[model samples]
Target: MDKISRLRGFRDIWKDELEKLRKIEEVARKYLNLLGFDELKVPILEKTELFVRSIGETTDIVQKEMFTFHDPSGDSVTLRPEATAGVVRAYIEASLFATQRITKLFTIGSMFRHERPQKGRFREFNQIDVEVFGSKGPLIDAELLWLISLILDELKVKNFEIEVNTVGCWECRKKFKEVFLSYIEKKLDHLCEDCKTRARRNPLRIFDCKKDECLFLTKDSPLLFENLCEECKIHFNKFLNYLIKFEVKVKHNERLVRGLDYYTKTVFEVKSSALGAQNAFIAGGRYDGLVKEMGGPDVPGIGFAIGLERLSLIVNTGNPKENLTVFIAFVDDKAREHLFRLVKQFVKSNIRVFYDPDSKSLKSQMRYAHALNADYAIIVGEEEIKNNIVSLRNMKTGEQKSYPNDLEYLIKDISYTK
Candidate 1:
């Protein structure tokens, strides 16, 4: 018989890695709550059309990366490759904007994309999605950027930099795309196959290509920032001023156009040099037209998502604390049964314990406890069952004591030890 294996690019987080994920989640949760953001859990599968309409048909996600399939009922459905589109759909379906002029929301979940898996990029990955709806103020962009910096600083993720730029609104983008098209047309035969297709479809996507030939040809390409319309220029300028006021260290990269089509005004990415090949750990920008474009109320929104897999890969603090883990050993059927019954109480009370229910020998159980590096161990035997007490041992100090087999009493003892 052959064993089954997990699909390529999927992930199974365990032990210390899972601890890091939970820690990062709590860190984001704390700051988001302080900033007054509400939590949301949207479905993983949505209508395929939703992403295509929002993420742009020309983008790689919709074109070659989405895990799309027809549903049982024949409706085209897709596992979400990105979350903003689904979030906006929910925002519209719930009419959240109508009830409150300004709505803030944050979500943490897995996003599926069928791209070739890299170091921290997987087919199914988790993200911390943060978005604010219903205000066009530049400070909102600054605030989102500040939130990114705060989380990274708290995580002690070093050597990360924030790169920002503006691609202007559609009107200004149209003017600049023409200038880029003319420059690339002269060297069209020399460009990569992908960039040639990009030239015919969406010329601006040329800046997003990483092929060596494309990168060299576009090195002297026209910059969109220099050609932005007055309104977009002023909006971007105000966004820059607000970042300064917030004391954020940002580098202006004129070529930093994000992959999504809905972005306008200000766009940014929080990059870490420590992450090779895939450098960005967090990125997003202002999308003033997405809500309206997706058939929702006309409102402005800005948000960013942190790739937890990528962030956890680079952050230094990922070890799990063993002091919270307790081990329970038994030497008889009666004691084993009692321990099993007490297991429910420990679970309900948020205690983590390692237990062997087969009444293994004390020496063998103690060796297993040592392997787990448990902080405390409780020996259960006929004597313990007869007395209705527990023989608790502090694994670190080799101290043993007898205590009433009461959950509250054990909790009190544990708390005191802590």
Candidate 2:
């Protein structure tokens, strides 16, 4: 039979890569917790209408990218293309806002989409999502950007830039859309087919097209900044002033309307040059109206999602060296049983221990320990067993010593040696 294979846009993540991501997650959790945001586990699947209402009907995500289908009972369900909608749904259904005036949530998990697979784009990918509710102050926006700066510094991701803009609220967005449509109406036939469709339905999305022709066509298109209402302009200006106080520099891109239709007021993206064309490692903005649209109370919200796959590429995710582990090798069945019992003791004391179960030759066992890059190798042989002692070899310095067979005592010895 042919070997089973993974579907397109999906692959397994092995140990070395997973270890790097795990370390990054640990650091992320620490800073997010320190910032007063609580971790939330949002489900992978949600009702279809939830997204249609929040992400918008004409957006590319809902029309083409979403992985949606009907179940046995024939209710439309979708694997989440992004996290914010599900997060908002949870915020409402669980009544999280009622308990606390402000809800700060962070989620790290898999997101699904049906986009073409490339270097960083995948059918199934992971994202670190952060959301804040009940606050619309421009200071909150600056603070979130500062949080992103901290995470990037901690991970040693040096080459990156923050691109920001404002899409305005419903009122100003409507006015801009009418103006944008007129500018592009005469030139629609020259744009990409997808942009042509978007021109008729949702013109703001034309700014997101990657085609050179489409980009040229929209080069002189109306800037949202020029059309911003007095209220939005003031809010955006105050946001920029706050960002300056935090020393978070940003490039003002008039065309930085994010892919999602829900964004309003402020939007930002973190891009890296390491990954070609698809370079955005993180993007998000304020979706002040999404809460009520998803059947929740009227509340302003803001959030961002970082793509871990792309992040792993640019960030210096070093391969961990297992320097604190020990490998135990036994010479006989009697020795195996005795050493196995001591393994539990090492674990209880928070020491890492591993053993070869086959009771292999001493020379072969030593090679296995070296492969693991162990700090010490504990050899249990008939002679050492008879003497109620064990031979310890330091893999690093090529030193050997005889210590009491008790792991509790050896734990202290190992600590002192370091």
Candidate 3:
């Protein structure tokens, strides 16, 4: 029979990689907490309509990438392609909008999508999502950007640029989309099929198109800044002023339309030169109308999400943690019984211990101990068991010491050594 193979675009995050991911998550959680954003968790599954309503009917996520299935009860369910929609749903369902004045939330989890996976994109990937509700101003936008800055700095990811934009409120967007699409429509035939389709349903998305010809066609297309309404212009300018005040570096990118339909203004993405053409490692923006759309009162919100897998790749430490802290090796079956009891005692005391069941030779056991990178190799032989003592060998230093069967004392010594 052929060997069973893992699925493409999805692979096991083995111990070493998981350790790196854990470190990244820990740092992210600490940073978010320090910023006064409480941790929040939203389920991976959500009603299909939640995404359709928030992400928009025209986007690829809803039309193509979503993993939608019908439940046995004849209801439509979807593996959330992103977290923001489910987050908005939670805010509305729990009535958090009315209860909390400034509900800042941070989430970390897997999101599913069906896109053809590549270097940074995958079928199942993790994201660190943040959402700030009930506040609207340039100061808040700057604060979020600064938070992102701190996260990237903590990870030591130095080569990243901040690209910012404002997709003005609904009133200004209607006019900008009209003018922007008209200029691009003249060159529509030059664009790819995806761009052509988006032109009709979501013209703003054309700016975000990755197709070679589509990118070229949108090179000189009218910018969204020129068509901003008085209110949008004021809000965007104030945001720029705040960015200057906070000393956050930002580049005006008219093309930064954060994909989601709910985004009203202040969209931004952190791009890295290390990741070639697909440079975004983190992206987010303001969604002032999402609350109202999700059946809550009108509330403005903004937040960002960092791609965990991509961040892990860029921030890998290359060191794998050892499985066992101490290995209990016995010389004979008689010694094994005593060692087994000692192993149980160590386990009960929360010590990381391992042992080979087979009565192997002393040489083989030592080899296994070295292979496992055990800190201490506790040797229990007939002689040692007779005296109610064990010989502890430090694998790295080739030092040895005899200790009584009191596992607690042994563990304390090992902890100090570590």
Candidate 4:
């Protein structure tokens, strides 16, 4: 049989990378809790309709990137392209919106999308999604954006810009779409193939197109801000005022039409040149109509999702911790039994031990101890077992001590956190 290999776009995360992921998640959890947000977990696989309805059917995530297949029961299920839709599904089905005016919740897990994998993007990726439900005021939007800024600052990611835009409400968006479409119709041939297709379905997506030609053509197109309805204008201005008061540095970008169709009013993305021309560390906006669109109450929500893999790529933490309490070294098979008992005793007393039964020679075992950075190496031979004592060698200074069954106390004495 031929040896199997991983698919082209997928890459495995090794032990070190996994450790970094854990650290990032830990910090994110702490920050989310500090904001009074509770943790929530949703499944990876969900019914295809959830994404089709939440993320627009015309969007690339639904039209191309989703991993969808029929289940054994003949129901179509998709590996979730994003977690926001499913999180909303749970909120509706469980009636979470009925009671709480501001339910701050968050989730950290992997999201799947089928795209040409590149730096910071993958077939399998992880994100930290946070949503503040039932908050219609612009305060919630500013609060969420400011919180995201704090997280990036804490991570030491210095090179980033917050691009902000307002898509206006339903009434204003209707008129903007009319003028916007006609403005770009003359330059249809100049657009990339994908942008040309999206022009008919979603003209706003054309601005987000990465093609240099399309970018140049739409560089001076009509902005949504010019046609904001009375209510939307007030909301956008209020949100801006709050951001200023909160001291959040931001840039006014009229072209930021978030990929999701559900977003209305405010939309934004945190861009970084460090990740390349298409870099965005976090992206989110106000989805004022999504809750109701998903069969829930007429509640509005705003939130953001941070790219964990992208954040981990730039985090330069010094090497992962190196500390072990007991390193057991045995001379022969006869000493194995005694070594096993000592190992069990150490573990029972909540002491960390590192040992390999195959390692026998004192020199080889000492090398292993140094590699593991063990504080003390426990040497056991047939003679030591007969005397009910074990030789403990200090790996740091080459000092030796004999312990008569007080392994737990000795380990605690040396392994104090400085």
Candidate with the greatest TM-score versus the true structure? 4
User: Model 4, 1-418: lDDT tens per residue?
Assistant: 9999998667789888888888778777877888899998999999999999999998889999999999999999999999899899988998987778778989988899999988888998889999888989998899988888777677676778999999887778889989989999899888899988888888888877878999999989888888888889899999999999989999998778887889889899988878864488789998989999999989998888888888787765557765457788887778887766788877876678888768567788888888888888888887677887878888777898877755665666656742
lDDT agreement of model 4 with the native: 0.85
lDDT of 3 by residue, 217-321 (tens): 777777888889888899999998988887888899877787778888899999887776557889999988888887788889888888988877678565765
Alpha-carbon runs more than 4 Å astray in model 3:
1-4, 209-220, 318-324, 348-350, 407-413
- What is the per-residue lDDT of model 2 for residues 212-235, given as tens digits with 9 covering 90 to 100? 999999888888899999989999
The best candidate in terms of lDDT: 2
Against the true structure, candidate 4 reaches a TM-score of 0.93
Model 1 scores worst on lDDT over the 10 consecutive residues at: 316-325
Worst 10 residues of 4 by lDDT: 409-418
Candidate 1 root-mean-square deviation in Å? 2.9
Residue clash pairs of candidate 1: none
Model 1 scores what on Cα lDDT? 0.87
Q: If both were scored by lDDT, which would come out higher, candidate 1 or candidate 4?
A: 1
- In candidate 2, list every pair of residues with a backbone clash: none
Encode model 1's per-residue lDDT on 194-290: one tens digit a residue: 8788789878778878888888988977789889999888888998898899888899988787888899888999898889989999999989999
